[model samples]
Target: MATMEYNVFVGSETGLLKAANCAEEKWNNLNTLEDVKKDNEICCMCWGSSQQEKVYFAQRNQLIKVYNILSGEICEEIELNAGEGKFKNIAVFDQQILTALDSGIVNLWNNKGESELEIKTGDKLSCMRQNFFKRNLVATGGKENPLKLWDINKPTEPIFTSKNVPHDWLNLRVPIHVMSIGFIPKSEKIVTGTGYHQVRVYDPSTYQRRPVLNVTFDEYPITALTVCPNGNQVIVGNTQGNMTKIDLRKGNVACRYKGFAGGIKDLQCHPTLPYVASCSLDRFLRIHHMDLKHIMHKFYMKSRLNCLLLSKKWPTIDDEGGSPTDVSKEKIDDMSDALWDKLPVLGSKEQLPSGKMQKTKKRKLATKELPKQKMKKSVC
Candidate 1:
């Protein structure tokens, strides 16, 4: 098969990796159905190199599969034995592969899949993220695990460790459950989302151990989050399927996107564009414009999605070979019309000969009826 370029790559719970071209509305399953197994389900994914020509994904089976974008084939597979639980996240730096497991074991593997260095971050590691600007720096956190920043070169103790917030006004201890982490660009600040519905920003440069900025979203636990390209805001998704963009400066909600039916699993902001892509347990991959606050493209994969990766080479709307705004608006209108047609219309109420109300079919009108007391008063 010829090499194919895709804008989006999605990993699913069924152990299937799919590539999509948003402009073309095309999808291709990179893995065969025969290889699909419970243990092969992908849990985390990261670009293998800055070139974006390859991808590294970790499975529940403790295997890291590297897929080549140029040839569209599995280039290599690295098995990980240093971790105990499922992989929470994976990162690539230099030529080494970094894998973090729920047991809090972080291992850096060489080309031969030999462990070069290992660091025990903490227990219940929910997330591990590398600083894109400083590839050698990484952050890790999880349930009851405060955020810690490590320098992979010197894999001894963390350079900076975050302290839990002080007790609440009622004198009750606060909980710590860092479910996701993101490093803001052009700065050393790190943002984290917790299971306690909190979004916090930590400044490593400051002597203060606690968060410099802390804000809460909805009532449910935050499951996924990503810093936007602007670095002034971060987008977060909760367990209840709510995705909101929050201004980091003031710690206020900027906007919220709709159309999610299940909890978000992963979120990725485009490196250069005003777009953010998200995958959810609802089995849908959606791309939304940050400013528009509306979905630009939505694709339904047969299996539940776990992680999403957006290529830096993703095509712009104009690259789709048409007027960008017109084409997108037309597509959106067609989809909306189709969905509206499928919905059943409510019938209007009408009086029958016996003074009872009857409904007329095929009409789009209010079907609500007056209560008995109101009806009697109106009749009298």
Candidate 2:
């Protein structure tokens, strides 16, 4: 394979856009979003075009920036009319840009086509995710908001909306505060995190409007949620700097991980590798191995990171020095082999079938016979 390739892009709280290509060798492609004052605090970014060279990003200043990844040039800029409230989510579908505002409004714009679609989500929004299997479908929710899915082609009504959980022991109606949302790949099922620090999975196909499975974490609002590529588990991070990998099938935490000194702003897992990258108020980008729970790469980007996007491609065995910075299976095997090579060889021992000890033969000392005469010689 001629160095498999995938693109990675991240936008930070300080309004910087970083881009790079992951390949067989260490990635040297990086960009700092410092020069453009308007690009500060990138809220969302994605491949706006079919080509790998172009991308679109939403900013905190109500401006959307389009850039050419290969040339490091701003190709176009579209301004959002939505007043106040930061952008919480953005996605590209059918050559149109869809942005969800914290104030609960979603706008779909086609700058080149000069067509726009807007919808009022009622309550303010915090996050939005598109169902890859259903390109025309999307899920959106936020603080005190219920998770809702809409068919973008219509934009007037939601196809599904989550029903609140039943009353507690006191029979008080439970309030909902959706903080983040994720859609299961290839299924109508969706998962959401809430301000109450709960993770719930909902299947719209079922008659029950309530979550099929609901689990709680630490008492902090969930800030980030990412479904594993396998679509069997979801990685959740909350406002308290807590992270956990929840097994959907088991309906419980599969593993607990540590390392975020500050609350996690965002998390993204490698599509094909057992690695996850996260950036947060700690001002550092950390890549972790899901299985080993090892921090593979730690890069101080010198800013509070709010979001991350990882490449889907991973290095393979045949590539030359495949991804020196990435901790893939090939790299781990090589490291294990090298580690075993450095271990000390043990001293050889005789093989024994039974639990018996070998007795040493007693030899008569040649000087023993003279021992009895030692006193006589000394006296002479």
Candidate 3:
């Protein structure tokens, strides 16, 4: 049996791991329904290896499963012993696995699955993301919890801690509910999406710990965000299913993407391609081109999706698994070819054996003349 090569991997709230082939517009459930349980619900997912040959997903029951992409099997399962609440995110750095829970506990496990270090950042943690350029660094923030950058090596104190913005014109303190966090590539700047419908950019290199730029989207809270490869813009989605691209330089909305029905749970951009993948509570996984106005592909998943990982190895003709072909075109072409082969070819001047070409005479009709209207014409 040949396994399908998937470019998009989605985790559902009902404990189903789905793999989607964007080129073919088809999806498959990696795990069966029998393996699904309430406690096994997937909360977050990340690539287990640099080559993306494996997947690492954390569940609600504090269990982490390593899925092998080539074999299509769960090769390893590691249960997290430290941490309260559900796992929020998982990251891998230098062969070490890091897991963060909503209780604000980040545990570092070695290759043997032994807990080596644990850092208690804070409570009600909503998001934790690893820096792409610096693997040892991570950023965390949540409801009432300010953004903090931590170095796993030190683990003693946060290297950078963000301060809340100043009070509004009404003298009321600004609320802090960071739903998603993303690090801008090639720079120390970090972008965060808040539950207060704000997209903020924090610069650690600055003297002040407050966000250097702030922009608001829709009325609802921003649920997910992903930084573009250009490092100058960020795409954010809210609970109202509205996604917008914000320019960090001018702090303005650049573009808005449509075709979502419910709250967006997660957003991930392709590492090199000009495409982005998103999963939502609407039970659909959609891929949109960064330069186009319409969506590229949309798949209907059976269960509500939580998080999705976009593989860097996009499907091509030379990939291990076969490439997706247009079945409808192949079938239609084959039928037309067969029909044309069986049909008889006729000569231009050929005639039937019973008779040659015959000509028929034209018929003439008598003309009728009416009384002339000279008097009426003169009056006109």
Winning model by TM-score: 1
Q: Per model, state how many residue pairs clash.
A: 0, 4, 0
On residues 126-218, what C-alpha lDDT tens digit does candidate 3 reach at each position?
999999789999999999989999999999999999999999999999888988999999989999999999999999998889999989888
TM-score, cand. 1: 0.85
Give one digit per residue, the lDDT tens place, for model 1 in 78-149: 876774699898999888998898999999989888998999998889999999999999999999899999
Top-lDDT candidate index: 1
lDDT of model 3 at position 84: 59
Model 2 Cα lDDT, one tens digit per residue, 294-370: 67666666667777777554445345655534535667789899999998654433443233223211223435656
> What are the C-alpha RMSDs, in order, of all predicted structures?
6.2, 9.3, 9.5
Q: Report RMSD for candidate 3.
A: 9.5
Model 1 clashing residue pairs (backbone):
none
lDDT against true structure, model 3: 0.87
Error of 3 at 245 (Å): 0.9
